[model samples]
Structures are given as structure tokens and as C-alpha cells.
Target: MGKRSMPEVPQTSGPHVPVLLDEVIAALSPLAGKRIVDGTFGAGGYSRALLADGAEVIAIDRDPSVLPFAEALDQEFPGQFSFVAGTFSELDDLSAGRGKIDSVVLDIGVSSMQLDEADRGFSFMRDGPLDMRMGAIGQSAADLVNTLETEALANLLYAFGEERKSRRIAQFIVAAREVAPIVTTLELARIIEKSIGRKPGDAHPATRSFQALRIAVNAEFDQLVEGLFAAERLLEEGGTLAVISFHSLEDRIVKRFFDPAKGGPAQSRHLPQVETAARRWEKIAKAIKPGSEELARNPRARSSILRSGTRTVADARPTSFEGLGMPMVRGT
Candidate 1:
């Protein structure tokens, strides 16, 4: 069968707009003729920008649903873009023998497309099935909500979402599910809302719990830690690594990876000075947040943060999860 052309994606409303785009491009200066990687490739926003700047882009996404979007990019850019339907953790192998990569960019957390599509079950805005797998295959949110013991569920919420009322919410869910399975996104949202009363104008009570479940379903943190190592291995000397993370947990992981002083095995202030080995990254910049103008244009950009660093000529070190400081969640 002949391959059919994909219709151009219409400009849509909501948080789909890439946040802090100009800042990201500036950080990745001298884009022309560079080979770069866009690890998330959500909606192809960053990839489009890179191609426009005369870069050869290798873009990846775990979600098969993004194939159409990527196909559109292929049609527009021809030889300038290549899309890989896989996680970024394998980026080293994906780019192997392709020669040196100039830069790598990762946008962490759920994309606006996922959240906006009710059928995808990422948001509680409109009731949908309790499934939050980034890719088509995996345990669904319903599976976790229905099966995990009350204590285990509570721990997951507390560890991942930092929800203080995790115990109460977990108790409520367990009791409710005993009657019948917690099947839909709203069903669980209601259970959480009832357990933790919401006040006027407060964020949805289900927000944190949903986030925790989505993270677990996608194994987001594990992928993130591995992706960091993969990027380090694929980048050439003086290559740039930029990460835009939306929440505190994601930001902390990036911070720990880039700045040894903030994360990982901490050095003792009292101990005598010892020479350090060649580091994988240098020139870590302060975290950059969206400006007022950006926030006004896109309210969703308020919580977005960008952190970046330049790769050094040193050999990539063994990956470490210790520096990320994530509380251990069993069976994630």
C-alpha cells in the first residue's frame, strides 16, 4: 500500500504551545549544520524550530500516536528530520555511529496533547477511562487503583505526589473499590475529592494523585535518570544538554545530574580538598522560568522551568539514581 500524506495539524488552543522556546534556542546557539536530538518530540514544536534553524534533528517519542505528527514533520523537512518511536533512554544506541551530536533537549512531564485529549485519560477535566500509559502498552491507572493495598497506595501518593492526605485518600479508594472497581478517571477523582474536601478556586483534588499514577504507569523517573546518562554518552565535547521540567521532582533530577553540589553524594565541607575526576558536564546555569509576558500569553507556562549545561570532554560516568532524591516506590 502506498503511504498516504498526513494532513497538517491545525493550531489548537491550550498548553500545547512550547514554553520558553526562544530561551531554549539561545542556549543551543549556532544551530546551523549541527546534529541535535529532541528527546520528547511532543507535537514536534522543538523539532520544527531546530529544523528551521538548519539543524539535522533526531527526534523520539514513546507514544505511537505521535506518528502522524512526526510524519508531517518528515514531509516538511525531508532529509533534515528523523523520528524514532522509542524512549530517550536508548538514545545512545539510537544515535550510535551517527557521529557526534551537537545538543540534546528533553521536555519532561505530560504533553498538553495528552492532557487535552479526554479519551487518552490523562486529565480529570472530562471523565474518561483510568488509563495513563504514555505508550499504548503498560499497566493502566485503573490497574493500580484497584489492586494496590491501601498502605502501598498511600505511600505511592505521598512519595510521588507529596500529597499529605495520602493515607486518607488511599483508605477511601480501597473502601470504595471494594464495592466495585474504580474504573473511570472521574470515579477516582470523586473519591479523592470527597476524602480531601476542596475549597473554592482550589486546584482539583485529583490533580496530585493522577500525576503520581501517570508517573508510575510511564516509569517516568527511571526513564529520566537513564535518559540523562544516554544523553551524556551521545553528546560530543562541548555539546549542550537542555532540560525543561514542569514540577519540583523533575527539576530536582535535572539539578542533581547537572550540579553535583546540589544532588548526588554530597562533598564534606570539613574534609580536605581532593582533586575531582573529569566531570561529564560543566557550566551549569541557574534555572530559568517563564517571564511575565510569556505567562500572560500562556498561563500553563507559569510552572515551567528550564535548566541547561554544556557537556565536557570527559568520559560519561556510570548512571546514578541516588542523586535524584526520589523516595523509593515499590513496584513502580
Candidate 2:
């Protein structure tokens, strides 16, 4: 994995609004003196809010560019906040010896900050490098598209993006890349759009393909799985874990994990008749959504779904990722 050259943070005219802000805060139920982890500290929105509510915040993000923003908050708040530059999947390591966390909040998926910046290559609306890395390091979306075989590319597009015409799109991309490597977001977007003809009321023919590519490029699903398990381990008994997922894929994973029926009775292959039970988390509330007012203000909030759970006072043994029963790309 190679890191991209840090570009100057461009002056953006608008502020990066955190989606489901009020809902996230209410679900988190931050209390003074309770330590909380803002797993995706993009633009420090949730972290700042938690700090304001008097909770000790441990803000974590993979991108180092957000460090200055978090650092500034640390200076202002002094001992109230701390920033760790790493993925939330490593929360266990980051929180080692700090005592069990009281609450953990993860606003999954790419942040507005990442999409607004053209140089980051997260959005097709802007012309930028073909990179779609959230951490800004590792093989980018371009690398995968240009190098993957037609079959692999098709599978990635279908599995990650949920594109119905993944085969056609992959064939078009593979043929186009033969002439020259796809290096920019617009070029790839055009290729996908052209392959899949626009529909009457479609927003963009390339939208789903772009999303699939970004999700694959970032390995978002894998990270989410790891982060969820890490949260289960980090949260103390009775601690809350709240997650707001922007898409069905993410929401499904969160929903299944928080469901009590998903996990079956554990049985060892050696012991054919013996069975053991495994339980880690308890669901707190049903799926939550933003109000119509929120949707009017930010259309992106329309698809967001919030789910929460509490760590139960059961055995704290680690469980297999398969046991969680979350939908994820195999071998991801």
C-alpha cells in the first residue's frame, strides 16, 4: 500500500454536514464523563458534538489529512478529546489499556469531505485520479479496474455495486482499458455510462458502477465487518453501539449482526451432539430513519438507516466473522 501525496486542503465554500446528526446524537445518548469512540471522525462532526455533550471522545480516522482538524479540537478542548490516526477496525489496539469504552458510534461509508475534494477520486461528478481509497493508501480503484481480469471485474462490480448489467459494463471497461489505462474518474464513468444506456428517469447510468468501484477499492465491507467485531470487543457490558449505514448493503450487515436469531447454536465438529450458545450483543432499538425535514435539507440522508445495540453480560469470547451473518463479499 502506497500513500498518495497530500494535496493542499482546498477552501470549500460549504460546510461538511454530518448525515443524521440529530438522530446519531440521540441514539448515542452521550453522557458527561463517559468515554465514547467516534469511529469515523470525518470532519470531526460527531466527535465535536460528543465533546459538547461533555463525553470524553476518542476520535479515530484512517486519513491523516483530518489530523489537523482533530488536533485543533484537542487544543481547544484540552483533555476532553483525543485523536487516533487509524481505521476504527484497529479500535481495540487504539483503546488498549484505556478501560472499556462506554459507547461507540460508527457512521459508515464515505464522508462528504472525501467526495467534495476532487483530488481524492471518490466521486465521478468531479474529474480526478481514478483513486477511491478512503485511507488514501493501497491499490486504487483504477489499479483494480485496469489490472483485474474481465471475470473478476464483473464479479466485483456486481457484488459490490449491485449493478445488474455488470457483465456488459465489465466487458466494455476491459476493452476500453486495452487502448489505454483508465486513469481518471470521468473517463471510467463515461465508459460505464456508455456501456449501459441511460434510462428514462435514471439519475446516472454510471452511478451504480461508480459506487461499486468505490466500495471495492476501499474494501469498505471488510472494514465494516472488522469494525463491528472490534466494537463488540471494546464496549463494556451494557455499553451502547450505534451505527448509521447509508446503503442497504451496510444496513443489512448491521441489522443481521444485531439480530438475536441470526446466530445459531454453536457446535463443534468433534462433538456431534454437544451444542454451545454464543451471544455478544443485544439489539437496543429498531431501524431508525431521518425525518422528511432532514431529507429536504440533505437528500443523502434519505437512504440512511440507524441501528443500535448494547453489549450484554454474556461470555466475551471472540466469534467467527461468518457467525455474524452479515452480507459481505467472500474473500474480501
Candidate 3:
């Protein structure tokens, strides 16, 4: 686990237009005097909006580079906004002793800021080190691609990315790395492209592999499961829980958690009475997608799905990652 050198100042850019902003706000309801947690405060879009509506916002992000943006928000609205540098999986501890949280809004997956910066190595569109680490600490993508066994690598690509040509791609990667370590985003992308020639109207051949690598590096699915449970613990009775997920994997986890009926009887009976923990969440809304206007303005919204639920009076129950159906990977 290597740390990237941090510059004195992080790159500042135009505000990110959050996906499903209006829809999320509407789901969260009555803002004034409420204390909310922006679980993934990438560009501070949700936090900024929440603060404008007179809510106390506790923003959370793993990337240290976003601290400058958080600092600017704190200065703009003194006492209204604050930030903590940590994964949303630890939101309960991060917001502990803050009293009853009124809402928890999570915009999951990679942010536009991470994707736009080539130096961060989140996207193949721009060449940089093959380091897809959201927290700036962990086993990087380069480490996994260069060392994991061929079968293991193929399984990772298939499980995380759902890449159909995983075997062929993994074989190519293993062969190529023998000559020289696959160190850059473009280098890996080139191997994938050569392994599976791109077809017309198809996305870049590297798309799935890149996604799998990023997900593994960040342990995103596991984090989402824990974060959901953490939100269940943090939110006050009748508080709102809003989640915006970018892909099916993320949306499935959120949807299944909010709708426990979809998932059968309690596997983890940590509670004395399982029935008491049964109805922890209520009024779970149907999934909401971005409108045509939003899609036109921000193409990023095309894959986003927003799901919400109201916390009930039932006691929050403890759960495991396996109970939440998160796929496991070595070193995650």
C-alpha cells in the first residue's frame, strides 16, 4: 500500500452537477434545522444544496484531495457544514454523538472529479499510473493486475465487471505482464483492446476490466453494504435514507437492503427478537431514474438510480457482509 504525494493545494474545478439532485432533495423532505450526512461528498454538490436549505451537513469523503472543497464550504456557511475524511462504511462512528441524524444521502461510485483527473488514474480515457484507489491507501490496480493468478484475475473480471470475455482478457494480461509490468492505464487498455477487438457502437473494450479493477481496489460493494447498515444505525426514527447508485451492482445492494422482503428471513439474528428487527425500514420508494432534461445536461446521470426509505421505530440490527450478498475478493 503506497501513498500518493499530496500537493499543498488540491486542484479546484467547476462544481459537479450531481445526478438526481432535485429527486434526492424531494425524497429527503423538510430541510430546515435537520442534521444530514452527505455520505459521499465527492464535489460537495449535495452538501452545498443541503446547507442552502438551512440543514446542518456532515460531509464524508475518503479522498484527501477533496478537503479544500470542504474547507471552502465551511467558510461560506460557518457552523452549517463540516467534513470528515473517511469511507461512508464508517459513517456511524464518524457521525457518532452528533445526536439524531435526520437524513443520510449517499451518491455511490466514482465522482466526476476523480474521473477528470488523469493523475488519479481512475479512467483509461487519459493515461496515468494504474492506481485506482479512492482512499489514497490500499493495494492499487497495478498491484492486482501485475500479480494475481490468471484464473483469479479472470474470476475478478467476471464477478466484478461482468466482462464476458474475461478469460481471453486475463490470459492476454498475464502474457503481457511477463514482458514488463502493466503500470499505466493506457497500457492495460491497449492489452484489453488487443485481446478483444472492439465492435462498432460498443463501449471501449477496457471498460469492464477498468471498472472491476477500481471496484476491487476500493472494496466498493463491501463498503456499500456496511454503509447501508451504518445508515440504519445513524438515522433517527422517521429519518430519511436516500441512495443514488451508478450501476446495477450498487443499485441491487441498496434495493435489497431497503426492501428486506426481497431477501428472506433474518440470516443474522443478532437481536433477541427477530420480528422486532424485521421492519427497521418503512415506506421504501420505487427506484427513480434521471429525467430527460438531466440526462441531456449531464450524461453521467444516464446510469444513475435513486432509491429512498424512511427509518422505522424498530431497533437497528447488526448484519454481516455475506448477509448483504457482497462478493468477496482476496485482500479486500
Candidate 4:
């Protein structure tokens, strides 16, 4: 598993430099004959790198717009690459018949390509439809903004976005929607800005609220917990599980999955260690943040962390969503 300069992963896609590329490649240590699953294919960055390393890759992404990228990878790698258009939570089923997967890599959260395309409505920097549904299958962000109760909306912002001014923002949303529907990104962005005034150098006032809406509309936290469990069941003994998360919430779930104590306080010597399920992962890396060089080149990698582990011979056990530090949004 020698490190090599990665080739550019390009398509008609937008600015998407895969975060922690060298670290991820080093963590998985892809071999020529090994099979790996790129659970969040995004713009095919990971899959292309793995394919270039000569590993057989199966990529999964729920966004149908990534089909062009997938098609290009499939063509470039031929037999060594395959694409699956489905959610990563059901990755095991989506990747069925790919025998004895040797590794699975998940890059959690929204893709840069999705954010760059204003039509997809993932970013407030540009005005687009208020839709943030990843696969065109569920309620749009506009649906939630237009219909969810103020309390529920506030809970959503507080839970998912970690926004301190959730109630005020939610109140503004309700009051504005009463005048008319909040049907566009700018419309909602204006409400948030009006409720929470902007500072001279701070980020846009709508950043947290938009992040919360995207998570709620797509159920990202739940999807992440399930995907972790699915990877547990999907990997064979000694397989690698590598995850790159851009936020604390996603990183916490990855940490708890690798840690035996669920990242709780250390057990005191005075008390006997309580019996827990047999260890499922042997961690090789924990909370490895981007280097200054990487951050300087790609500022989007600033908040990202890479955590990886090797699968053990033990059996996989049940996963608890709430136990993993995932916030429950009270039916938002």
C-alpha cells in the first residue's frame, strides 16, 4: 500500500477536491485484487482513486445527477469499477453479490457538486428551488419550511444545525410564510437574515438554518447510523472501514462505533467493567484532521476528520441511533 500522486478526478462536475485523499488511501491500503465500496461516491473522487490503485470498486450515491460521473468512472475502469444508485444506509443490499468486500469508505454529508449546482438547492450562496431532497424521492426543504410547525422547525434547527437562534429563525419563517410561501433559497435566506442580523465578517446568518433543513429533509444523521451498522454487517473479517466526516455530529457517530464504551467517561477502577457486545472494529485512526497544507489548498477540508478501523472476527451487533449521539428532532 504505497502512496502515489493521485490523478485528477474530473468530469463536467464542479469544484470538489476529495478531502483527506492521501489519508483515506493510506487508511484503506487498497490492494490490486481487493474489493472496496465507496459508499458516498459524490463526484467519483474516491472511486477513481481506488480504481487507479487497481482495487475493484463499487460506488453508491443517492443523487441521480452523479450518474454522469459514475458513467465516466465505469468507462475508465471497465471491470474494476461499478456504480450503484441508492442510499448508503442500504449499502449491503445495494452492493449484493460483490463477494467479501475488503473495505468501505464513507464521505458523509452533502457533496460539493450538489452545492455548486444552484438548481439542486443545497446552498444559499445562490438562489435556486428550495428543494434539498437528495434523490427526488422525499419532501423538499420548502415543504418543511412551508408546513412544519414553528416548534418543530425550531427543534430541527437546534438539533441538526446547532443554531442558537433557532426559535427566532423559526418564528421569522412562520411569519413570512404567512404572507406567501417560502419557495426559493433566497426567500428563506432573507427570513433568516432578517431574524438574525449579519455581522461584518461572520458567515451568512442562514448557514446553520440551511444546514439543519438539508439534514432534516434527507434524514442524514439516521442514514449515517444505519450506514455504520450496514458496513459492520457487510465487511468480512479484517476488512477496512474508513469514514470522513465534516462535522462533530457525524464524527461522534464514527467515534462511538469504533470505541467500546460509546465514547462515555472512562470506567473507574472501583467498579467492574460492565459486559458489552464483543468488539467489532479495531481502529487504526481516530479524528485525523486535515493538515495545514491541505487546508490551505482546499479550505473546505478545514472541518473534516478522518476515522478508520479494521473489522474484527467478532459478530456484528445491533446499533442504537440515540446512543450514538445523533440528535432526535422530535418528528420534524
Candidate 5:
């Protein structure tokens, strides 16, 4: 029998420049003996910095490609670092039996490593396969557009991408796909551009469609809700949780979770208002943005917003998954 071939693994080189590096480090306030979770350890930029500051770091990512980099860092730091290959939403499971974590930092949205690589299909600027699964698994953006009904597609585009012409775009996609499947990023981009006429000085015609597709493909918003709640559960009293979000959808979720709100309208007339205990996190700082210096260095940092909060000693009951507006999946 011939030897079976192994699937090719994506190769990543160079380091992902950590955005707002100094700000994140300052917010985290890492010290010796503190255990921290770098939830999105893309290329270990933040993880490397955290370890250098003498904290015990558990760095994690959904992309298994990052495992090699983690291994390299483990060798460099030995006893001070560990890596887990999974989404931050599974923080509780990943930290099972590990006890409380002192701090958790999440750098959300698409990483530069993913966007810069044409093969990953994250950017419309670079043509590649239509696959946009962040973890290299499950349905691709191509699959969703090719398979979903026009109404569902339109809703997804509007809700996730905040695209205004979702119905028109969805109609165009459905019509185009009937003749031929949209197999690549360029194919979809062209269809969307045709549906919605581009403005004179518009950024790219397909930007919103691509963004919508990526969000749907990866269930990015859903995972974010879960991850935030999971981080809240994992933090010890006085522990800090910091998140960097690239879009308003993500920022809104983080903002609401950190703010005080009752779970829902009174369950019944007899039941008193079930005010959610004062939020577990006390907002430490207003949303932080990259200064002109950092933005000049990395334009991608322009939309990024960083929000940090410290956990209070009062045990605020964890928000139910549904209460957080997380889309429920059978088994994610």
C-alpha cells in the first residue's frame, strides 16, 4: 500500500506586531507569580511581552498554526508559559482545575497574520479561496453564501456586516450563484460591487460583504459573547480583563456586559425586579484607542478600541449564555 499523505499545515513566519503593546502591558500590570491568559496569542506578540515581564502566561489561539510559535516560546520561557489550542470562549474548559487567573487579555478581530496572507482569503484586496474560517475548520464563507436562502443571507449581512444594501446584494449573489458557484474571494467581491454601485472615493466596494462573510463563517460575534462571559468567570478578585475590538458590534457586546443591567423584564408580576448584581467588572478606564504614534505605525489599529475592567470581590452571578445574546450552537 502507498503511504497515506498528510494534510498540509499553513506556515506562519515573522512576529505579529502587538497593537498598543505598551498600553496593554501597562493595563495588565503583570508581575511575578501572577498567572495571565493571553486569549488570542497570534504569533505570541503579547504573550512574549507578558512572559518577559515575569508573569506565568497561558497563551491560546484557535488556529493550530500558532502552536509551533507557542512551542518556541515555551522553550524560551520554560516553566513560565503554556499554550492551548482553542477559542477563548472555552477559557473555562481550558483553565479547568488550573484555579483562578489573575488577568486575561483578548486581542479580538482578525489578526494581521490572517489578513496579510492571501491564501487565508480574509482580505478582498488579495484574491484567494473564499474560505474564511478563523480556525481552519467548519463552513467557509463560500459555503454560507452558496447555501443560505436569500433572506437569511440578507439578514446576516445587515446584522453582522452592518451593510445597508443586504437585500440587493443577496439577490445579486443568489442570481450569480445559480449560474456558477462563488468559489473565490474575487468572485464574491465582484458580484457585491456590481450589486451596490461604488462611490467616487469609497474604500473598497466589497469590504462590507467580505467582512460580513467572515463574521458569519467564523461565528465571530457569538464566540465573543461566550468568551467575555468565560473570562469573567475565570478572573480572580482584583483580576483584570482587557479586550481590544476592531468593530462596533464587538465593542457593543463588551460594553454592555461590563455595564450594569438587570437580566430581563420582571419574570412575573409577583417577582421583584431581578437586577443583575452590580457588574462583576468595575470599568477601569474609558475605551482606549491607539495614539497617533501607534496608528501611524499600523493603520489597522485605527478602528481598535481597548476596554479594561477589574473584577470585584463581590461574586456577581455569571450571565446566562442566552442572556448575553449569544447564538446557541448545538455543539461548538
Candidate 6:
């Protein structure tokens, strides 16, 4: 658990176009005097919108690369905006003493800023270090790929990336690493491509492997679950919690949080079966996807799903990660 080097000043990632902007804004309905947490501040797109709507925004991001964006936004809005250099999982503690949070917006997964910069190692389109760490801390993708056994690596790819050819890919990786350590994004991508040749008009062969490594390096699913629970506790009664997830794994967690049936009983193993109230959400609107216009302008919204709910008066309850559909990698 050590901090990685800070990225260079933000690269030009085009204009910040947050996915499902209008839809999220409508769900939040931020107004003057309202306090909201942009749990994944990324490029500050959501925070900027909340501030413009007269809400006080507490922005959170673990990657130091976003500091320039966060700092500039703070200066632009003065007291209306503030930045917290941390993960969304700690939103409750981070927002403590900030008063009752009226709403929390979590746009999960990698951000445009990270993807656009090859140095961040979030994308294989550009050759860079195999360091897919959102928080810029702890063991990196290079560490896992080099150290993990063939079976463990394959399991990770299948569990996290859902890569059907995980076994073949892992075998190839193990063999290749014997000659030389796989250290760069392109370097690993080449190995996967060599094992499973890519076809024209199909997604990159390395897509799933890259995704799997990034998820493991960041412990993204676990963070998402904790972040959701923290939002449940942080939001005032009748407050809003909106989450935008990029893939099915993430969407599943959000879907369960909003549906009481999938949430199971509101009791934790350590707590009494009887509680004053269930600290879960009262389901709100159905899953919202980006419109045609948004898709045309922002291709990143193609796979995004937005789920939202209103906080009920129930007390926040304890829950397990497995209950939220989070898959575990044994012996990590």
C-alpha cells in the first residue's frame, strides 16, 4: 500500500462530457443550500453541474492525476466546490462534519482522463506501464501479472473480465513471462493477442484481460459495494443516491441495492435479526440509459446504466460483498 508517482498535469481529454448528465441531474435535483458528494470526481463533470445548480459539492477521486481538474474547479466556484483525494468507499468518513449530504453521485469505473493518458495504463490502445492503479497506490498490474500462477491468473481473467479464453491466455502469459517479465500494457496485450488471434470487426482480444487486471488492481467491485453502503448511511432521509455503472458486474450491485428482494434481509450476521428499520433504499425509477444523442456525442455512454433511489428512514444495515454479486478471487 504505497502511493505511485503522480501523473503529469491533466492531458487534454477533450471537453469533459459526463455520461448520463441530464439524467443524473434530473435524479439529483440539486438546489441552493443542498450538499452533494461527487463520489467519483474524475474530471469534475458531475461536480461542476451540481455546483452550477447551486449545490455545494464535495468531490472525491483517488487518482492524483485529477488534482489539476479538482483544483481548477475549486478556484472557479470558490466555496461551492471542494475536493477529497480518496476513494468512494470512504465517502461517509470523508464527508463527515460536512453536514447531511442531500445526494451522492457515483459514476463508477475508469474515467476519460485516465484512458486518454497512456501513462496512466488504463488502456491498451496506447503503450504504457502495466500499472492500472486508480488510487496510484499498492501492488500494480505488473506485480499481479508477473507473480500470479497460471491457474490464479486464469481464474482472475475469467471471474473479473469474463474472458472465455482465459485458460489459453494465461498459459501463454506464463510461458512468455518465463523468457521476460511482462511489464508494459502493450507487452501483455501482445501476449494475449498472440494466444487468441483477433478478428476484424470484433473487440480487441486483450480487452477482457486488461479489464480483469484493472479491476483486481483497484479492487473495484469491493469499493463499489462499500461506497453504496456509505451512501446509504450518509444520505439524509429522503436523500438521493444515483449510481452510473459501466458494465454488468457493477450494474448488478446497483440493481440489488435498489431492490429489497435482492438485498435479502436487512440484518447483518453480527447484528440482531430485529432492527428498528431497514437502512436500504426505496426503489425509484428504472435503469436509465444514455439517449441516442448522448451516444452519438459520447460513445462512452454506450454501455452505461444509471440507477437511482430515494433514501428511506430505515437505519443503515450491514451487508456482505457476496450478497451484492461481487465475485472473489481466492488467495489474492
On TM-score, the stronger of 4 and 5 is 4
lDDT of 6 by residue, 1-332 (tens): 12222122235544456888888888887467889999999887888777877899999989887888888888888988989888899999999998788999999998877887888888889999999998788989999999999999999999999999999999999999999998899999999999999999999999989999999999999899999988988887899999999998889888977774665665678876654335467757799998897788878789999999998887887755656767767556
**lDDT of each prediction vs. the true structure?**
0.86, 0.80, 0.86, 0.88, 0.80, 0.85
74-128 per-residue lDDT for model 1 (tens digits): 9999999999879998888887777679999999989888888887888988789
Worst 10 residues of 3 by lDDT: 1-10
lDDT of 5 by residue, 1-332 (tens): 22112212225553256777777778888557789998888888778877877899998899876777888888889988998889998987797776668999999888887887888889887889999988889999889989998888888887778888989999999999999999888888889999988889987878777888898888888788888888887886899998999888788777767764533454676877555555587756888888897777778889899888999876756555555444332222
The total number of steric clashes, by the backbone 3 Å criterion, in model 5 comes to: 0
Count clashing residue pairs in model 6. Answer: 1
Using lDDT, give the best candidate's number: 4
Ranking by lDDT: 4, 3, 1, 6, 5, 2
Candidates in descending TM-score order: 4, 1, 3, 6, 2, 5
Give the Cα error of residue 40 in candidate 6, in Å.
0.5
lDDT of 2 at 256: 69
Off by over 4 Å in 4: 1-6
Per residue, candidate 3 scores C-alpha lDDT tens digits across 47-162 of 88788878999999999888888998899889989899899999999999887899999999998889888888999999999999988897999999999999899989988988
* TM-scores, one per candidate: 0.93, 0.89, 0.91, 0.96, 0.87, 0.91
lDDT of 2 by residue, 226-316 (tens): 8887888788789899898988888877776776454557555777674335667775688889888777767777788989988898756
Provide the global lDDT of candidate 5 against the true structure: 0.80
Please state the error at residue 60 of candidate 2 in Å: 0.5
The alpha-carbon root-mean-square deviation between model 4 and the true structure, to one decimal in Å, is 1.7
> Regarding TM-score, does 2 or 4 come out ahead?
4
TM-score of 5: 0.87
Off by over 4 Å in 3: 1-11, 265-277, 328-332
